[model samples]
Target: MKFTKPFLVLATMLLISSCNSIPKNQEKVISLKNAYQKDFYIGSALDTNQIKEKDAGVSSLIAKEFNSITAENCMKSMFIHPEKDKFDFKMTDNFVAFGEKHKMFIHGHTLLWHSQLAPWIAQIKDSAAMTNAMTNHISTIVGKYKGRINSWDVVNEALNEDGTLRKTVFLDTYGKEYLTLAFKLAAKADPKTDLYYNDYNLCQPTKRKGAVALVKNLQKNGAKIDGVGEQGHWNLTSPSLDEIEKTILDFSALGLKVSFTELDISVLPNPWDVVGADVNQKSEASEKMNPYPNGLPDAVQIQLAARYEAIFKLFTKHQDKIDRVTLWGVNDGQSWLNDWPIKGRTNYPLLFNREFKPKSAYNSVMSLKETKK
Candidate 1:
């Protein structure tokens, strides 16, 4: 069928408009897990709601983006072993089952921590009693998930900012032996599972030295430690890229793998000069403190993107030494930062927004390798 001159002209115009609508670069967007699969595991911490799959959107995002999972609260001593004699594995079991269903690496957070100690365990004053408590707790928990859980934070935040061992109930009662004892117990319970000493402020020279000393002490005592976790609870600035790179290299030099567990970059003004992950610290909320009550501005979003890009670039550079990078939460709305430092403040921290959609930071991190190539 031959078209008239006007009909032919209109068809040609229509075809040109359709071609313009299609993007010139049609590269597919990669999932977080797939983007770094060859380098290391990409993970996220799951709360109770997420574990139970209460929110389908959150669950779907987690399955698609992360290849590893950590229980944000349930696996801690406070929740898993609430009572001295009673062990509750309700939520903990669900957490493990979810990870297994997705074929993700399951990380058990905090076999021993000072902050969330059970009241009964904290009240025990006798060294023998504390030893039994520590042994029982570590053995029972670790043994139960012996082959299932891939790794554990055997000890968390045991060092003070000055790099000395913090005087906790464990340290006061069991002395420095508690560190080695916990690791030894975990190693005995699950010989195949990886054990790590995790802490915050590890980027600081003093604290980094403390960690190195602690690791050496554990080694001297014949404790089996596989890696060290530097809790990446950072802000928009501070903890310079050089400090982070040094921390990774220093830990790697110890012949142990490095992981950025609890990774989140807060884009908010810290109330104090030095930022920390101390749960006890609190600041009264004010209008100035809660700058982005509605949402982050475009300029601030751009800055966040750049910050994530720089950090991921460093991670990609030393991918061989790193084992995993786990985000603290799945999205900004669920981030613990919202209530930390200053309560009731809106904070944008993670790569995903409140709606479980990728933010500028997410795109920046995902495209890091692409830009290099």
Candidate 2:
């Protein structure tokens, strides 16, 4: 009650110091002046929230990475067939137009996918009707955007965990031959668009082996397939450097361009304390029982950044083998990390910080020694 003026000033200074010590939202505030930017392409998904004509973040990313945009879910069958007899071209058109205006390359997410297909596609008993419907859909939608989309996920997620053909409307009706037909159909629709088979966990040996065989088989048949999309949804550790390098080499030997598509490495708190969780999960985990904390400790965050550096380093070494590098989502806010593997848990596996600013991964990527020589 009787404090002197000096004591009050000291108290105020201490309070201010503590407040400044707290970590603020630094992720979103990126400087447009980062000089070490790479010429390698950078892109994120375009959604309802991000479709605005004047998005500074999007614009900056476009300015920095040159708008190599990826269509997220719109080109999929689900959005196309929300109702029959009527196809929605709103988002697809917007995506293509955005890329055109920005003079950036656009990727057509998919011509065929098992998870996001329409319900009615499976009911057709007549094989011809089914084939016609598929052909019509691809020829219409993809063909409509023909000269626009530079690359296409001609088929997405068609393989099961064991690399066997997944049972979906496409396989059941068109049989295993549908994949080949789909690629050929896509090629015919747009002879110039690069056709790709895109999927996740491609770095794993078991899955990579299957994909290699599949791509080689497609090549033998003279399918105009152009590339492989390795969805890099990696964990903190799981896939070792050996696995990823071998994977890149294995796919490259197929004479198909390789793209590290949909890449995002999660660096969130490890839930090792949970019951029935594997103790020795990934090579990077420090402990099996409780791998993650509320905020990732500084030590682990450094490892996370190093991991990003290592991946990019590998990418640089194999730059000749890669065609494009696309992240899964635009930012952490839109990432699938929220509901995947462990639903409802906070995950931090992206280049942008939670605040949308670039993280250490950004610096590491920019600092990577280009191996293009």
Candidate 3:
């Protein structure tokens, strides 16, 4: 039917309105959280800056992409209990509030780790005193976040590369029994929170064997072992896909949830012998090491995308056994890799760039879920 100019315009407006009214689910979905909504929770570790909502953009991306959050440093023993008698929960309280505000799953980074322990912990001479101190620390900290936190890295990096327990003060004083003691204390403090043994280099056969034995022993002693976290601090190469998959399968075989905790893919050079995530290890910065000081080359960026895609592909494959895959940082600029091994070096290792924009790697991972459809 022929219509006047005003009627035609009205007709066109109505059509546009009807199209816009289409359901949100019918739209082109391209979010990391939406992509993996069925697979597992996508998580990122937040430092004080982000937890305090320093940048609205960073916080927005976090609330948009991630469904789980871990404190990068605030929840650590060093930060939570800096002084012998004092326990600081100010920043951590804010962190937990942020997670709760966003309705995100909260994961406590660690209860015990040799590196970041307060100085007094290392100075305790008597075995009874040391044991009492540890009990107090775990009880107080874990008790504070008892019901709020969803999981805790009960013990971190407890094994040496050679498949032996690291001689930390806890191990030195209580021997291997220290591990079970820690878990037992955590279980008592928060029966609802999932307790985990988190460590780096778990993909290595020797380390994997050690982790298996550790978990079995925890189970043997009737400790409440809930999950194991394999820190995914890998690069474009190394730690073959088979190795990662094997670690996941092996850890899952224990009937405990597995997490790819601290996930990042550093696109920088490392010393020939540097392997595993030992915070103490350092290599002097050099021109050769920081080749991408200015920016990642296109080729390297492509490789980074592929690396992340491959990792997520494996995550999807083992969705049943995996609980969460948490990136170590929110974005490349905030990534610890920049200053870790060698200070003052630029490294691109996260799914987002310095500006909080999703990189090709982010798209690559999101595409995995789309392709499955």
Top model number, TM-score: 3
Candidate 2: tens digits of C-alpha lDDT, residues 1-373: 6999999999999999987784543323232122223434566666655655457776556446435778777878878765556788887788788888877778988888776677677566666877887888888887898788899998887776667887877788778878888888899999999999988777777777778877877887889889999888777785788888888788888888888778888765545543111212232333332345355567866877899889877876777888788877766667776544455555667777656677777666655532221
- Model 1, 1-373: lDDT tens digits are 8889999999999999987785635545579998788889999999899999998878988999999999999988888898999999999999999999999999999899998778888898989999999989999999999899999999999999989999899998989889999999999999999999999889999999999999999999999999999999998887999999999999999999999999999999888654579988888889989999999999999999999999999999999999999999999999999999888899999999998999999999989755544
lDDT of 3 at 268: 88
* Decoy 2 TM-score against native: 0.80
List the candidates' TM-scores in order. Answer: 0.92, 0.80, 0.95
Clashing pairs in 1: none
Native-to-model Cα distance after best TM-score fit, residue 318 in candidate 3, in Å? 0.7
Q: Which residue pairs in model 3 clash with each other?
A: none
Of the pair 2 and 3, which is ahead by lDDT? Answer: 3
Query: Model 2: residues >4 Å from true position, as ranges?
Result: 1-39, 53-58, 268-295, 369-373
| Tens-digit per-residue lDDT, 293-366, candidate 3 | 77889999899999989988988999999999999999999998998788889999999999888899988987
Clashes of each: 0, 8, 0
In the order shown, the candidates' Cα RMSDs to the true structure are 5.0, 11.1, 2.4
Q: List residue ranges in candidate 3 displaced over 4 A.
A: 1-26
Best-fitting candidate, scored by lDDT? 1
| Model 1 root mean square deviation, Cα atoms | 5.0
- lDDT of candidate 3 at residue 36, scale 0 to 100: 85
